[model samples]
Target: MHAFTVIRTYLRLGLLNFVQYRADFFLGVVNAAIQFAIQLLAISIVFNQTDSLKGWSRADLIVLVGVHAIVSGILGTVFSPSIGAFLESIRLGTFDFLLTKPVDAQLLASVQSVAPQSLTSLLAGIVIIVYGLQTGSGFPGFGSVVIFVGLLIAGLMMVYSFMMVLASLAFWFVKLDNIMNIFNTMFGNAGTWPITIFPGWLRVTLTFIIPIAFAVTIPAQALIGSLTLANALLTAALAVLFVAASRWFWLFAVKHYTGASA
Candidate 1:
């Protein structure tokens, strides 16, 4: 209850701040439009050259792209902004103030800032998904949609856990922003495409080592009604493992964190 109140308060304040910058909303919409165009064009060019990339058809690829956009929007709108602030606060020794508060530092840091502008990407993603489904297999059955939503939630949790793990590294590393750079690059380049095209080793790396598989591609599989039993089980198991590991690692990092006073 206390945590929910804090979150609600921060969210309200963030929205107030966001409304103060009306231009940002337009800019975000423009950027989302441009991104949607480029991504659609790239998919078009690929399908024009070949009817299918691996086993994924044109509509399948479009669904994948939509899932990518939705995931990207979520990361940008929520996780990335807070993680950035947490890292910066750690670097500037302002994390001391957070530790002094009664709330859990992790929760506080996770919701520290909000970027409402990135909701444009989520809207764009939804539009693309509707376009894809309508033009292809049509909307999924209720069970599939339910499963897809579950997978998407699990996938987002994994990504959040991974980002939290990375942010916690600020307790030790100096040039830590580069880690986010690598993640963004890989997500844009690799995650937007189906991971099945990659070689076996790279596929394993993306699935377990990096999380692109569970985050973007696997949920896509559910949406397209091709989610395998093995993949579904793996997604659930990995989500749990990632959350637990991230939590433990965060606690360890916080335990060892040296504040300005220390």
Candidate 2:
């Protein structure tokens, strides 16, 4: 309960800070709009060439785009900013202050910063998802909606765990901006399509090594009605495993963290 309260307080402060800078919020909206437009144009051009890309219809692909936006929005809104701040703090030797807090260091570090402006993508993604559902496959039933939400949560969990593992690398490699860039490049370009379109070996790598396929593709399958019970089970299992492993890795990194004093 205390943790939840602290999270809420941090979120409120973040939102308040975002609103304080009206110009920044508008810039964020404009940036997000331009990016969203380009993605739509690309999707349209792809459909112009072929009716279906690897068995996924244009509408289905639209949902995939929305999923990507939503996932990206969430990352930007909280995790990305927080991770960036954490890394900066570590570099500046200010992370010692965070470690001294009564709360869990991981929890505090994860929610320390927020970018409410990034929510533009999240809201826009919802609009795109609704439009896609209207155009293709119709609306999923209540059960499917429940399942999709579950899978979406699972997808977010996997992505967060992956990022955390990467962030943990900062304990040794303090300058790791390139790592986040690599994830963004791969996820942004590849997550727009069905993972099935990839070659077998690459698919295995994305699903297990990088684990991005589980982040965007699997939950998308749930929404499009292609997700099977077995796949859902696998997603749940992997989510647990990723989270646990990331936590362990984080602790190991902390053990070696030699604070600002060092």
Which residue segments of model 1 deviate by more than 4 Å?
Answer: none
TM-score of 1: 0.97
TM-score of 2: 0.97
Error of 2 at 6 (Å): 1.8
lDDT of 2 at 17: 95
What lDDT is reached at residue 56 by model 2?
91
Model 1 has how many clashing residue pairs? 0
Question: Superposing all C-alpha atoms, what RMSD in Å does each candidate have to the true structure?
Answer: 1.2, 1.2
Clashing pairs in 2: none
Give candidate 2 regions above 4 Å deviation: none
User: How does each model score on lDDT?
Assistant: 0.89, 0.88
In candidate 2, what are the lDDT values of residues 110-221, reduced to their tens digit?
9999999989888888888888889998988889888888888888888889999999999999989998889879887887778888999999988887777788888888
For all candidates, the clash counts are 0, 0
* CA error at residue 212 for candidate 2, angstroms: 1.8
Distance (Å) between predicted and true CA of 67, model 2? 0.9
